[model samples]
Target: MVEKEGFAALVLRLRAEGISDLDLLTAVEQTPRSLFVPPQFAEQAYSSRSIPIECGAFIEGADLAVRLLANLHVKPGQRVLEIGTGSGFIAAVLGRISERVMSIDRYKMLIGAAQRRLDSLALRNVVLRQADGSNGLTGEGTFDRILATAAFPSMPRFLAEQLVSGGVLLAPLMTGEETCTMVRLTKTGSRFDREDLFEVPYLPLVPKVASFL
Candidate 1:
């Protein structure tokens, strides 16, 4: 297992890598990645890499989580929505920066496991649910910011509609050739402005109904 000092050093390395957002760095420090992973993988939790959680799901790399959080531009008291709650690490980080966070995953096992971790951390502002993330949570109404950890072939219109005007949505869009690229969409009035952020590798965004039990 990594000691506290080692975890702090990892955060410092992330800072040197251009993640200048102080809030994100602080969140990373506050939420030790080791606590969110399985006991066997605790040693590699603080490493700058992704870890498989369960049912083919993964806990995203700490650096990538910071990049997504930075791009979302989340503010205190803002309501944010996260599509994948693997290990609930990113959702907890979002909770640290925002007033409320609703994170949904298709797998019940993952949601249950993540909920325990979040509860142990006393993150009351984050709500975890087991549902089809691709459909988004329209019943929860519009969100100030939305982030999808999984990659999709195309933007889900339902998710776009759930964004409040002037809201920002970040997700990885996959090309026909199976390459993934990060995309940022800002909802403006009835239309949206899209910007391609960068290329990244992410798991496919699968719906609950589409998943094999």
Candidate 2:
């Protein structure tokens, strides 16, 4: 269980890093990381760093995850798509702000575990699916915001198209000479402008199949 003091410490730490949104802080406080991580690592759930979970996968750095989510500016009743659901912790956070959330993961086991946990918490607004996230939640319609937890060599153009005008797409991209850079891509007329935030290490985004030219 995450006690108040521990949660407060986390908020303070994130505030030090320039995240001062009280709503974001409350979302972090309300979401239980213990429910996301494996049973053995529950004690370390509220810490700011990542921890190894089952199948050699790791939970995200709490601060980094929070920062990524901050970029979403999630509003009540907005539809959001999350790539690389991981332990579903971020999904849970988004659930607090959005009317509906669709999160995808390639690994079946991770989705299964996350589903059970989300059910236990009565988080019905979010859907977890086992699929290729790079596909950008096809048939789900355009989204108000799209967030990718995984870093890839390049941002998928489909994801860019999926974002509604005035919406934001946040992901970590591998730019030249940089292993990972968090990018904020906002759609304009015919092109999108990219703004880099900070360095991060995230799992690679799943590749998409293409038709032969």
Candidate 3:
């Protein structure tokens, strides 16, 4: 069973850890982490640690998700794109703040599960799809913000083109065989300014066809 006080404490701890965005904090509080995790691990859902979900994916801990959201600086009425939709937790949080969120995952099972979770929460602003995130959403035009929950060998070229000028793109850039660093790229004119934020581990970004076998 999950304790309400424990969950509230975790949120408070995240605030102490520099999550100053009120909206993001509220989203974290509103969305129960247990709902997004495997039922077997529901008791540990609010423990401020990553939990494994379906399709060999891990839902980022609440603190990490809040930190990423803070860096993205999502705003109301802004279009956002998320590369990985694991458990749809982050997408649901973004939907609370952004005008609309388009999330893509290569795994069909994960997409279906995430979509159901978001729908249960009545988060109508998010659209979930199963597609290769590396290529981004073609023919969908540009987005005000783009985020990748997976790590790539390096910054993807296609994502840069899909971002609107002055938009922010946050993703984990692999720095070593088993290590990665979070990078923030701000699109400026035809160029993007890169800033290395911090180190974090994430599943490698890959392009895979959705399978329903």
Candidate 4:
């Protein structure tokens, strides 16, 4: 199994690669990726590559999340929403940067397992639920930030409507040749500006009411 110090070394590399946020770097360092993956691959936890976990899920690449969060102007007391909880690694990372975070996944089992991991880590600010992440969170008129780990063919209109007037939404928008094009949508009055940050490959967003994408 990878040692905690080994993961720290990886985070340090990520930092040198242009991720300068200390809070984010620390979150990625402190959150144990090994705990969320299957026991067999626990040794590869912090290797910077995706590994399969239970329920046919794959842990998200830390670099992808690092690229997304790098553009987010998230504050410590901000309320954030994370879609596609996956192995809950990103959610754990988000927990360190926000006061309250709600992460949704289409798989119930993933949520259950993630909850146990979060509980074990004593991460109390994140709430996990089984729901369609593409549709965005309901009843929340505004959010300080919205992050999606899943790739969407097009930016969901619901997500656009949910962001606060000046908030930002980070997700992978599918573009040609690339599996996903990392884009940031910044809400401005009634319009949003899309900024392409990088390219990535992620599991497709699960449709409403159906899990297992």
If both were scored by TM-score, which would come out higher, candidate 1 or candidate 4? 1
Q: Which candidate number would show the highest TM-score if scored against the true structure? A: 3
Q: What are the Cα lDDT values of the candidates?
A: 0.84, 0.81, 0.86, 0.81
Off by over 4 Å in 4: 211-213
lDDT of 4 at 206: 58
Q: How well is each residue in 62-132 modelled by candidate 2, as lDDT tens digits?
A: 77788888877888879999988778889989998888999988777788888888898899999998777
lDDT of 1 by residue, 1-213 (tens): 374865676768767877678877788778878888888988877776888889888787766777788889998989999998888999998999899999988888888998998888899999998888878886898999999978988887778888889999998898757789889999999899999998777878867652544
lDDT of 3: 0.86
In model 3, what are the clashing residue pairs, if there are any? none
TM-score of each: 0.92, 0.91, 0.94, 0.91
lDDT by residue for model 3 (62-116), tens: 6787789999998899999999898998999899899999999988899999998
User: What is the lDDT, from 0 to 100, of the residue 54 in candidate 2?
Assistant: 60
Q: Which one wins by lDDT: 1 or 3?
A: 3
